[model samples]
Target: MQIRVADKAIDLSEGATCASVLAEGLSKKQFKNTVAAKCGETIFDLDRLIPAGCDELVPVFADTPEGLDVIRHSAAHIMAEAVKTLFPEAQVTIGPAIENGFYYDFAYKRPFTPEDLEAIEAEMERIVGRDHSFTCRLVSKDEALSLFKDMGEEYKLEIINDLGQDNYSLYSQGNFTDLCRGPHIPRTGMLKAVKLLSVAGAYWRGDEKNPMLQRIYGTAFANPKDLKTYLHRIEEAKKRDHRRLGTQLDLFSFSEEAGPGMVIWHPKGMLVRTILEDFERKEHLKRGYQIVQGPLILKRELWERSGHYENYRENMYFTEIDEQAYGIKPMNCLSHMLIYRSNIRSYRDLPQRYFELGMVHRHEKSGVLHGLSRVRAFTQDDAHIICRPDQLLEEITGVIQFVKDVAGLFGFDFELELSTRPEKSIGSDDDWERATTALTDALESVGLPYEINAGDGAFYGPKIDIKLRDALDRKWQCATVQCDFTLPERFDLHYIGQDGERHRPVMLHRVILGSVERFLGILIEHTGGAFPTWLAPTQVRILTVTDAQNDFAEACHKTLQGVGLRVEADTRNEKLGYKVREAQVEKIPYMLVIGDKEVADNVVNVRLRTGENLGTKTIDEVVDMIRNDCLEPFKRGGMSYSFF
Candidate 1:
């Protein structure tokens, strides 16, 4: 058989493997780093024989993304082996490579502890040192079932029965074997830089009804340097975790009594939320959007008409009211459409944008909820634009620009992704194509780069998602613009055309800050709880040096508050240094020091959150300085703000 390796053509024996061909073409170093081979899009294990019609072979290097996935997947199998060796009664279930790491679930007698993880990691190192070859073989379903059944692996038996396949592939290294469709690394020795991260409890198959299993998380890299870099990032992420900072900064809390996935906002947290809401309202109004409100729950029949009952009922909360079924909304679009249809006329009202800071509820699984990021009850900065089909592209572009402006204000760099239709959707093929084309065209028209995300769009239509990259290079999905022709058609929404005929108006469902709670959580982590001057919940804290200065501190606080600044006074009977330290820990943007000297001069000393101390300034000067600081972010975002 003849095959192509890079630019060279080589003739190989009939039973030659991919590794044999690569060994002929690549240098020793390159061949050692090659974990797998790719033929077009299909990846192949090194020991797999080259198919008759195969044309080209591309080496998948260990450092590449695809190669890393293979390495991580093989590492997971090794970890499973280590676990089974250490704990003979433990049964391993599915383990796969996730983003940045891998996890394996084991149905053990009890939850694994931190000490167990250390032992398992040590066993993994020994396995790597043994240099066991990963060999693959095909087996009939009956044979695989008998093999696992005899070994007392009930989970594997259940998986095999559920798969209902004629044959299965099994990968074995040393005495341990696992059911997998794998193109793993050639040997266990290739897994040199690996670390066990943590352990958590998970229900089998992510169903609450199933038995709980112990899941061990871990990661692997091509070399020690890369692994060290990744570990450092992990440590940094711990420091920036929003849930910890939220408590330290006294921002918010969650209580088991109030139920999980519900945020109980503290005063300071609520103040921050209010500031964000105010900014949203002003920005929307300037962009020709009308503020609106809708009822929290509506008739179930209404949801059915809008396709939510059929497609999204699982995530919705439902109840009975007056012998009628009612569903608490998971989205704000239905009511916005009703408002548009209340009374409408000509094309002049075609591009009506309705905005709301609407609160919504979703039946999120308890296991998935994390701080404010994933919550059952939260508010969305949602909007709906009812526009003529001719105005669709312009409307999408406008929303894109709006997202850009908002991201700029927060000093975020973002990326765009155009998501296409999913498997279960409401729209027709033509409508889906048109909606996707409109989003793609809008992105191209603005000369912004974007990648296509396949089959991840909303059930209603295709969308453009904007993911913000924060200070630590973590991405958050904050904004989205979805184009929909299905919802308007479903509701029979129309506008009068110049031709004296009614035409179906297209709808756009969008959110600048997708979930207010989630956005706040991201913001907390992005800024490390030290918000910018304009967005800080408490802009200034007045600190008095002694009892004699308490009255002056009160006056200073009043003056600052009178100027529309969020201010508080630290008049407690504590030392000046202690109060200053407390204020700093709270991440207050500014601190005003009032002492005997400041009182005599009728001035205040300004200390910034960055630890910069400006000399004493008069009250009027201080007010002007803060006001300018408040306007700076708006100016950068190409917007304006007012205190009154």
Candidate 2:
């Protein structure tokens, strides 16, 4: 057989393994760093035999993303082996590599504790030290079932039965064997840097009704340096956890009495939300969007007509009112459609952009409910545009630009992903194709790069998802623009064209900040709770150095508030240092120190949150400085704002 590695071709026997081929073809260093090999699009384990009719072998290096995934997967298998060795009664179900890590689920007698995790880590280290090579074998379904059945792995048995395949691949290292289609590293000794992070209870396959299993989360890297960097990021993420910051900053709370996934916004938190909503309203109005409102619940028939009943009902909340079934909306597009249908639009009005800070509800499982990011009830900065077919591309491009502007305003850099149709989606294949193409065309037109996220679009149409990168370099899905031809067709929406005939219009479902709650959560972490002045719930705090300066502090607060600044005065009988520290802890942008010098001079001493003193400034100068700081972001985003 003829095969190629890099630019060289060689004749080899049919049963040559990838490892032997690489050892012959690649340099010593390249062979040492190679964890696996890629034949065309398919990755193969080093021990796996090279398939016939294949010609090229591309090395998968240890530091590459794919190679890391292979490493993590191998680590998961090794971890599973350690668990089985340490706890013979444990029944392993499945383990898979995820982004940045891997996890294994085990049906055990009880939940694993932290102490157990330590022991398991030790066992895994011992297993790695033994340097056992991983080998694969093929078995028929019945034989696989019988083998696992004899081993008393009920989970494996169930998996094998459900697989419904004539043959299955089994990977084994040392005494541990698992059903896996794998391209694992050659040996357990390849796992040099691994850490078990946490243990949590997970349902067998994420179904709440299934038997719960203990899931161990761990991550592996090519070496210890990368592992240390990842661990540092993990620690930083913990410090910036939104839930902890929410409580510390008096932002929002979740209460069991109020039911799960419901955000109870405290005064400060609500103020921040209001600021965001108000800004959204102003921006949309400036961009030719008409602000609109929709009811909290619509009749079930409306949802049915929109295909939500058939495709999205599982995630929707439904109720009955006056013998009529209603669905509390999980999306804002339906009502926006109704609004567009209420008017008879002409081609002259090619696009009608309707904006709403609409509150939506989705039935999120209790286990998936997160702080503010994933909640049952949240508001979306939703807008739907009804445009003639000819205007579709331009409208999509405009929305993408709007997203870029908004992200820039928040000091965010984002990447775009074009999501295609899902299996349960509405619309014809041609419509889906056109919609997907339009999104891609818009991205290309603007010279913006995006990835294709297949089978992850809305049921009605394909979409462009904008994921914002935060300060910690974490990505958050906050913006999206979805193109929908199905909804307009389903609702019979039309606009009079130049030909004086009714023509079907295209609809766009979009959100700049997907869920206000989720965006705020991301913003909190992104800013580390140090919000910019314009968006901060409290922009400034006037601190009285002494009781004698209390009156002046109140005057300064009034002056700031008169200029539309969110200001507060700290006049308690506390030390000045304590007040400053408290204000800084609250993440306020500016702290005005009102002491005898400032009170006598009719000026305020300015202290920034970063501990920089700006000398003494008159009330007018202070106001101007604060306003400039507030408008700086708008300028960066190519927008104008006024503080007066």
Cα RMSD, each candidate: 1.8, 1.6
How many residue pairs in model 2 have overlapping backbones? 0
lDDT of 2 by residue, 386-447 (tens): 99878888999999999999899999999999999998888899999888888888889999
Error of 1 at 500 (Å): 0.9
Clashes of each: 0, 0
Could you tell me every candidate's TM-score relative to the true structure? 0.96, 0.97
| Tens digit per residue, CA lDDT, model 1, 9-70 | 88888788999999888888999999999998899999999965788898999999999999
Clashes by residue pair, model 2: none
Clashes of 1: 0
**Residue 396 lDDT, candidate 1, scale 0-100:** 95
* Each prediction's whole-model lDDT (CA): 0.92, 0.91
